[model samples]
Each structure stands twice: as C-alpha cells, then as structure tokens.
Target: MGVGDVKRRIAEILREVTDEVWARVAWVAVDLTKELIRTGRRKIAVLADDVFQAIGLHKAVAYVKGLLGLIEYPPRSVDVVVAVVATSEGLTRREIGRHRWASHRPIWNMPRDGFIQLYGQIPGGKPPFEEVWRATGGNSKLLGELYKAGWSAEKALREIADERKITAFVKTLRDEERELLRRAVDDPDVLFTREDIPLMERLADLNLIVDALPERDPWFWAGEPPPERDPELGIGRHIAWQTPLHREAVRRALGG
Candidate 1:
C-alpha cells in the first residue's frame, strides 16, 4: 500500500483492536493538533516507517507543536494515522536517503562516527540505524526486510536474505519481539491469535524453521528419556535438558 493508505490502515487497525477507545481517541486528538501545524489544516498524517527514517529532532518538535496547537477543544474523535513499514529486505542507502515528504530535508553527509553522534541527538531508543546500514552493506531496504523476518544481528551475519510480506503484519513490533516468537514456535498453544499463524507462515517462508518428521522412528525418537529418582529427594520430576552438543547435532540433522 502507499504511505497514506498504510497510515490510515494502521490507525483503523489500532482503533479496532483497542479495548479502551477513549485513550486512543485522546492520542488521536494530539495527532490531529500536530497535523494542523505541519500541513496547515490539510490533514495531518505521519507514516510510522518514514518517521523512523526521515524525521529528525528539529522537525519532530515542530510537527508535534503544530499538531498540539491545532486542537482547540479535546473531546472528539481525532484521526491519527500511523503507518508501520515492516519489510523483509534491508533498506539501501538510496532508500534511506529517499524523501517521501516535500518538507523533509536531505540527509547530511557526515563521517560515520560523527553521524552516530548526530543520531544520539534524536529521541527514542537507539534503533541501530547506523549499525544496520553498516551491516547490510548500506542497503536500508534490505535491512528492514531482515527485521520483518525475525532475523537478528547474529543471524544476519550468517545469511543473505530478502523481503516479502504476509497479508497482515504488525509494524510496531521490535527486535526483542523475537523472544515471543521463539516461545510461540516452541509451543504454539500458549496464546492463539489470527496473527500467530500468518507470522508463523512467514517464518517458514524465511526458511529459519521447516516442517518435517523423520521417515522412521529411530531409537532416540522412539521413546522418552529414562526418568531418574534421587534417594534423598524421592520422586522428583525428571528434567529433559538437551545439551549444546545434542542441540547442534539436531540442528545439523534439520539442515541448519
């Protein structure tokens, strides 16, 4: 979808999923105020992905002030469009430099170290912009794609990958989100949701995990491990722990 459509869709989705509509409505009011300042009542909407890419410190303040000043009265449904751009491919240098908005400024060309310092001036967490740029060989779009696929710094170092999308993707998720995914992959029945299957399918697309079973049951796969009991501690539960070596062997078997 285009940027505007993406933003609108995210807003709509957020509203749909929100149990507390009033809280979200309040935020929308703030967003509308910002919109007025930035676009002079032409309808204010910010693409989430683009904000991560282009909106610098100075511009973000101006955008916020503009929006806040626009709202005279608070009790209303304010439309705050948030577009989270989740992609599979890492971004290219050119992609990062691309300006989708008319008022946005060109990225300043600074030495690597200096630019890192410049990034510190911006708010929010350190998004690994410089690190990803350097890691992906300066391909920003490709970097974004890797993020969408649940790949990590360690995994990225070991593989070359691409970008594709599932029908519905959550753009607001972050790198640490993989922990939840890992849990779901291990035990899918934990908490079921429509998004769970689509994301799981996407992981399968990345080839990080596969679906298969051995042709025949071998000794190890045939039965559970032996249970042990301690004399002092009677009838303690038998823990099943796969050692790193055993895990590696299984990984090799699985074509890791």
Candidate 2:
C-alpha cells in the first residue's frame, strides 16, 4: 500500500473504533460529564497515542478541540490530550526536541498480569510466561510485532529483532539519553530525585523509561533496583526500561 492508503486505513480504523467507543461508552462519557459538572469538574482526559507521529501536534489538538466544542452540554468539560511526547503546547510530536507534555501520566507499560489476559486470546497458545516476559517486558508494541510471526513467542522474539528501529533509535540519541540508555542495560532502575527530574522528564517523554512503582514492588527482573532505594531518594518511583527487549537491543547498540 502507498503512504496515502496506509494513512487512509489508519483513519478508517480510528473512525471505526471511535464509533464503537461512542456506541458503547458515549453514555458513560455523558453521565460522567453531567455528574462531574454538578460537582464542578472541568477536565476530560483523552489519550491519543502516536498522535504526534501520525499527525503534527498542532493539527491534532485543533481537531480534538473542535470535537469538544461541538458537544451539546452544560458541564463545559475541556478535553486534555496527555502526551507520550508533546510540544510546548502539550501535544505529542515525532521530533526529538519537543518539551514533553507533563511527565505526570505514565504511558503504556502493562505488567505481568496483563500478559495473562492477552495470552488466553492468542491462537496457537501462549508461550511460557517467563520467556514472554523476558523477551518483551510487557511492551505492547514489541509483543504485537512478535505475535505476527505465528511461531512460538520465544522463537519469534529470537528471530526478528528490529534492526531498523534500533538503528533509527541509535541515531536519535544525544549525549545524555545515550548515556542513560547505556547505563540502563546494567542497572535498569533510573533513580530520579528532584535533581534528575529534568533529565527524567525528557527520557520519559521519549518513551525510554517508565514509572515503575507500587505496581511491581520487589521486582525480580534482571536489573531490579533495591527495594529500599526509592524511599531513600524520595524519587517516588524508579524509572525502568520501556521493555527488556529494548534494553537488550540498546546493549547491543551500545556495544555492551
């Protein structure tokens, strides 16, 4: 398919999914606004994944704002699109040097329990949980890529590493992100105190690390942080590799 066809298909998928969401959850959204408005609520959070990559931030936000303006209601809820990587006006962008939305919200990183739910749906059968976890680290993007191979999950992971994606990622790294990703292979937990927040914010915005807190306490992975460290630094949560697979890829990229 040409780029135009690909974009058209994506639009079609989004339109279909939006329709489905409205059909099923529109009432919930309406009720939520109504009740929340009664209580003086003003923010309606909408997550737009890859919005920056697919369409520039400005246009995407304008489109969403237009949608919000059309809502016939009294609560006056404003839609706020949180970013995976946004520009200064709080919109996700594909470019590397954008000021990330608000590093407050955690992006997509499903824990192990989520894998069980996903496993049951696969056709051939879920591979061993440990192997799957090791290979993908609950990263939906990598898992989706691996799932397409139709082989056992382990085999798929072993066979098709994204050399191109890794190459692109390598080229984008600056001095700091490169150093951070390099260290991540040896010690996955990035302790982000107030001092590291700026760097952490940038890294998180880039989808390099994610907030790993209360969810995976006492984590038992290859480079798990010490349990007591987070409390001592007061860094809320230890930032972790987006995926073990990515970390492994980085290790190879960094000549580890």
Choose the strongest candidate by lDDT. 2
Candidate 2: C-alpha lDDT: 0.48
Residue range 1-256, candidate 1, lDDT tens digits: 2346445744775766543543344345455445444543433444332331233433444444433334433234445433222212113212332444312222211334544555456454445764543443323333454565464554443333212221122233454444555343333332234555454444433323221222222342322222232112111122111111221222332234
lDDT of 2 by residue, 1-256 (tens): 2335434544554565554443323223334444544554455443333433334444554434433433444454545422132222112422232324322323334556776688667677656767766767665566777777663554443443353355566667677777876665566565356655665555555455554443433344323332333322122336565566545655676667
TM-score, structure 1 vs. true: 0.21
**Model 2 ranges off by over 4 Å:** 1-49, 60-64, 67-104, 150-165, 168-180, 188-206, 211-236
> Cα lDDT of model 1 overall?
0.35
Error of 2 at 73 (Å): 6.5
List clashing residue pairs in candidate 2. 86-91
